[model samples]
Target: MINGSGFEWQESVSQLINVLQRSDFAASFLNSIKAISDFDSAVIMAYGVGPTPKILHDQLDDEYKDAFYDRYLKGAFILSPLYQSYKNNANGFFHINDAAPEGFFDSEYHQKYYCYSGLIDQVFYLKQFGAGVAIVVSLARTRKLPPFSRLEKMALKSIESIIISLVAKNWEKLANDEYKFCDYLNKAFENFGRSVLSKREKDAVNCMLRGSSSKSAAREMGISTETERSYRKTIYNKLNVCSHSEIYHLFFKSLEFADRGEDCDPLSLLWHSAKISH
Candidate 1:
């Protein structure tokens, strides 16, 4: 018997069972969570073998949805606290504040994306399905709402098992589709700068794609933060991109070209265009 802090766990389970049967399981999952503790918005993403996370579902405002998919899913996801937690193989529900790295709010990523989103608080329920595949269901409260209380967290945690089970069953079928997407992305990143960029510049781009700040990338590369910044600038110049958002778009467009079996070389095209503009 399912029990929780004044939540109808059994009903939720029943609904989830029905929802899982549908083709749109992601939307149904989000709805089930909303019934228990209503949040301002929600997002569901799948992470696997790719450098980018695929947004399986989202309920963000239309105005921001494209920006999120184009920017966050493309590159900014690397900087997300929850995404890092998933990388570390962390599972279960967690508040954004709790999972965030030290000085996270002060970071450039927060300023550029999280802060601009106007989402004051967030909680993610993470489930890992081995082989580097995972899904994160994020519930967010707007700036006007209060943070999720302890009781709310407890109630959500109580139903975690049911959620995981439902998602796992659906994911088994979904994995094949995701595999292809991941393969394309992996190849895109692998071949992205092979012809034009130095090894260090490529490494810096990969680090950035994984959501690393200059400091974090520097730490990993055994270089000074200033040196990391220099590498980023050089990479951007070589690629003819000015911002992280543009980098994400470039990666996405390249992957799309690959999927279509086109003979187009997106990087070469971008480089030539940039050169001509100079």
Candidate 2:
């Protein structure tokens, strides 16, 4: 049986059923999770083919909203393993650490951007609607709070099907065609290093963007750490940027180039554009 405040199964189902096809579904669903567990906050995001995910609901405190909406929704999400799961059409339950690539915590992703956003740990309940769309309910515990325990995870897993079904039924009309956006982050990230980098090099660049160290990046790519080091070195030489911060600046600079509406390598465009002519 699920734990925490000890919500009975029948009572939980009734509460959920009442909220179906209603705006309160997300809130009720989160409340049910809280009734059964100890998480502090939750966000329901509708993701589709693009990087832009609509925030269907969030019970975030005022303190965390800036990072959650301002930075996370903008583009940093591309580096998220959760986003990777969505892209790969993943379903079911996952603790951030369980599904994340090894050495995820060591990376400067700022705890995959949560370091900056201020979440210590997270769990997800994802339900993919089709080839092109899904909903991810990201449950989090803030700083100073311990992450969910193994027992809690097991309890959540046991009820995963029920959680997914309720969420899916409620948001039944969601579709990828309905997911749309024209944002600089999406365009810039998609085209950032595509021109100057080879396919393998692009993979390396992605790892770097995710803040994976050479050893971890190599481990994920199934290459030696030395080879990963070489890839990073080569990328630095190819891009003429000495540090991660410079690469980031290049990424930001590319957003300006991306504004021109072409999906070409923003780095190449940034260097060659008349706008930057001195």
Candidate 3:
């Protein structure tokens, strides 16, 4: 029951879901976006939490992408109104140069960073995903091309919803997995440093999560205070969280407790409350 272009899009969605479910986190995401949009280049940008909005993945001509990243670091397009407004809101924005302001895309900033970089038409989609609070997926065509047509935009919107749901589900699993792993660590006291923990910087994290203060955690793990601090830093970094409190909020409260039962979830209560509010 599949047609021509419609079937192509359906296949794209299925492939994207698979990638999001099981693939190298960054590479797969970029590949999916590129496939869906039929664009020459795509990059996923994460903002706010990091030192800068990082180009986590880009499938562009390397000479183009590297120069774009380099100029991007030099305050090129970050100041554009289009970029600013997109950063201001957590939503998707799509446009051609004609659709943007008269001088906006023509500014010196735009020309050097975006125009010359081979990005003629652009689509910027921002939302929460993965471990980051704010993630932006930007797809662009370096060559001059028409903006996405009405049907294409609809396809993008549909896929965007699927992407959000998938991210939420995976984060839920990670949270549950972390909680279970922590339980095992607490009771065993056996070295968790080798296998799964090795990839996750587990020993130091387990020590702290099991109620060791940073100083005590360092001593118990037999690493320098600085090394312990560095390990803790990586934990927070990879998790896209700040304090232990935020960690609890994201992984424990939202993901972990939500899985416990509907009766125990604050979001569930809020959902029911909203239903009654109207």
Candidate 4:
């Protein structure tokens, strides 16, 4: 198997080299990775100190584009552990199970988008370069295939340096103007309900969004279990939400009316829209 894979990898690299500095490079690069393991779709994005990420290349099927492009780009990427890792300056290969938050598989964020998109597993190849710009390739697997095997992981790791070096060299001069924007949607989530929820209540909301239970949230916040429960209740009352699920739903619903260039609680706008509609 190793010798067979070696031959395949050599061939893939030859094909990739042929496309260097061309529009087809990213697509060819993804195909090169196929020598190690299979993936359903792939997207190469350039992220920087900006409100949005620039899609350098992609071969996403029609089914997953809405979830990956529209929703995730709009605001959902803020909750992605992969995106958070990039923000924190950690780069290289990251698999979904290794990178997601605690209880992330069970979180509403995962269910609503990851599962909704039919993606069962995802792996990213991220490399930061040139100030705030980072290039990341997300390779996803749908339910049609099992997760990457141990041997495949080893193969990917062994060649990580070669791949990342080529990627950085190919995209080193990506334009900054193509990537900058106001991060208003992310700020809306970070400061959500700030006008109505107290500091403690805000913490509780953050915990809830990340799929933390009351006890777990309290432990992380250095508060008692009962205090966390009380905070949750207050949040529900202030936001007029009834349960954990409602809180998660409202988070995105409020985003539909987010102030695109301002830091403010998006919930207020949601309320105003509701009132006006009536």
Candidate 5:
């Protein structure tokens, strides 16, 4: 009985059937959702036992999309309120605000990264597969609009079962090959600075790598700008790197080296020497 602007349930069903028959089921599924409800943007992501999240589909603005993957997905995904909810095995539609920690909007990660989207409200339609795997469909509303109303939430909720079924049917095809890069990046983050970098230092580097400025990173970490700058300096000294660019290059190079199955231990002689000097 769902109805929208010239949209009927029968047509929606037909659209879903047609999409399921297509090669790109994920894209088709998103389109089908659009035919039912209007959203400013949407993204479909798969989280697994590993660290990297697999993006199955997205309809975000190009710049926002880039920032999401290049910065947020790299490390901040762990801190994402929606991701945490998914981890807790929470399913169904969730307002982003409802899922976040108290004062999340004031957090630096929200200010530095999430704010870039200019979205005022976000909702995730989450479906969990197992203990460490889940798929999330994120819908966002622009600042110009009000938050999603109860009717809208119900409309999305009504389709939850269908979306879950579609995702379950198509996940193997959508995610199998797309997870490799994230896997590598996760490994790189895990082994790269573990022995030398403190947790806060690593968090700063992760923020920086995703293109946050020192000020932004500092804000996200809930520290003063001076402390942020100090952390950056400490990271540079510990890694024995002269610049942020070098650190960036070193990270990817390590990834490449690891891909080649070479021993790229960051805790070798160089790390010890840097530790001694500091």
Candidate 6:
């Protein structure tokens, strides 16, 4: 049965399959949930797979969403009792604001502020497939809600199963590819830690490649020479490449993207672009 959401359950499951086959992994996750749940917002936090654990994809108020992201970066949620509860009870899902374990949803911090952020109730599923340690996938609503219906619970389980299968197969290669890119980046930028370059340095490099000069680049970017010099120093330090030519080589022809997951490809880029645009 389709209910009022426009698609029947069978068509919704088919939609999930289509989403899984698409290049953007996040889209698949969200589509799976929309197949069964009705909520004003959704967020997915991915951990142990990236340089940082962050909201992989979300549909929420932009400013509030940014605040949540900032909070995640600060590791507040990572250390929360709610997260701990999710870790303890793996695989099965739960309601975050419900009668969770003692000291779990009893966070003084959450009640004081985040409760008003429309993040009151949530359903979470924990899985530990590729990374070994558990990774939590949460679907939340700003408003309070009843527990997931039996059908909704089953749908969440199905989505988790699909995620487990896909990640176990591709995660190691994805990790390796990220490592390779980071290694190459480090090798290319090895010299920047020593001497900081001036604005003249950056302008010299950027302009040389693109027919821009320090003055022109500064004018275009609307910054003072001194500020430009500061950027140059930071770029030089981070990239470790002293000369413009080295940075050019590092970015241009020498760059490589192999062993990349399907989600890292051009089609994924297009999908994300489309999502962000809309």
Query: After superposing candidate 6, which stretches have Cα over 4 Å from the reference?
Result: 1-7, 85-89, 97-100, 133-135, 144-278
RMSD of 4: 2.7
- Cα lDDT of model 6 overall? 0.47
Candidate 1 per-residue lDDT over residues 96-167, each given as its tens digit: 877875446665567778877767788888888777788888888776678788777777777787777877
Worst 10 residues of 5 by lDDT: 255-264
lDDT of each: 0.71, 0.77, 0.51, 0.79, 0.69, 0.47
Off by over 4 Å in 5: 1-7, 172-278
- Residue-wise lDDT of candidate 5 within 1-278, one digit each (tens)? 23364346447666666666456766767766766666767888888735567777788876567668786676566557776687678987787866776546665567656887667788888877664578888988776567777887778777777677767666644445444333444455556676678889888876666556667777779999899889989999998889876876566545433343223444343444456889
Clashes of each: 1, 1, 1, 0, 1, 10
TM-score of predicted model 3? Answer: 0.49
- List the candidate numbers ranked by lDDT, top first: 4, 2, 1, 5, 3, 6
Cα lDDT tens digits for candidate 6, 1-278: 11234355455556545555345756565554565675556665545444345355667776466656655443334334444453344554555544243333333335433564567556765555433234555666654455456676556555565555544333324333332222222222222222334444544343333323445556656777666556766675665668544544443322132123322332233334557989
Pairs in clash, predicted candidate 2: 109-113
TM values, all candidates:
0.65, 0.88, 0.49, 0.87, 0.62, 0.48
RMSD of each: 5.4, 2.7, 20.2, 2.7, 7.4, 17.4
Weakest lDDT window of 10 consecutive positions for candidate 2: 1-10
Model 5 TM-score is 0.62
Best by lDDT: 4
Give per-residue CA lDDT, model 3, range 1-278, as digits (tens): 01236466566556656655454666755555545566667676545443345455667787686666666543333344344444445455454442244334433445445666876667656565333335556667666555566666666666776665544543334323222222221122222222223533666654543334567667767878788888878877765568654533332223312323323433333335557989
Ranking by TM-score: 2, 4, 1, 5, 3, 6
Poorest 10 consecutive residues of model 6 by lDDT?
A: 185-194
Residue-wise C-alpha lDDT for candidate 4, range 1-278, written one tens digit per residue: 12247789889888787788898888788888887778887888877757777788887879778888888887787777767667778778877777766667788888787787788778888888856678888888787778777776777778888888888878877735555566666677788888898988998898788776677778889999999998988888998878888988888888876764476678888887899999
What is the RMSD of candidate 1? 5.4
The sequence of per-residue lDDT tens digits that candidate 2 reaches over residues 56-109 is 999887888898888777667766878878867899999988667766677656
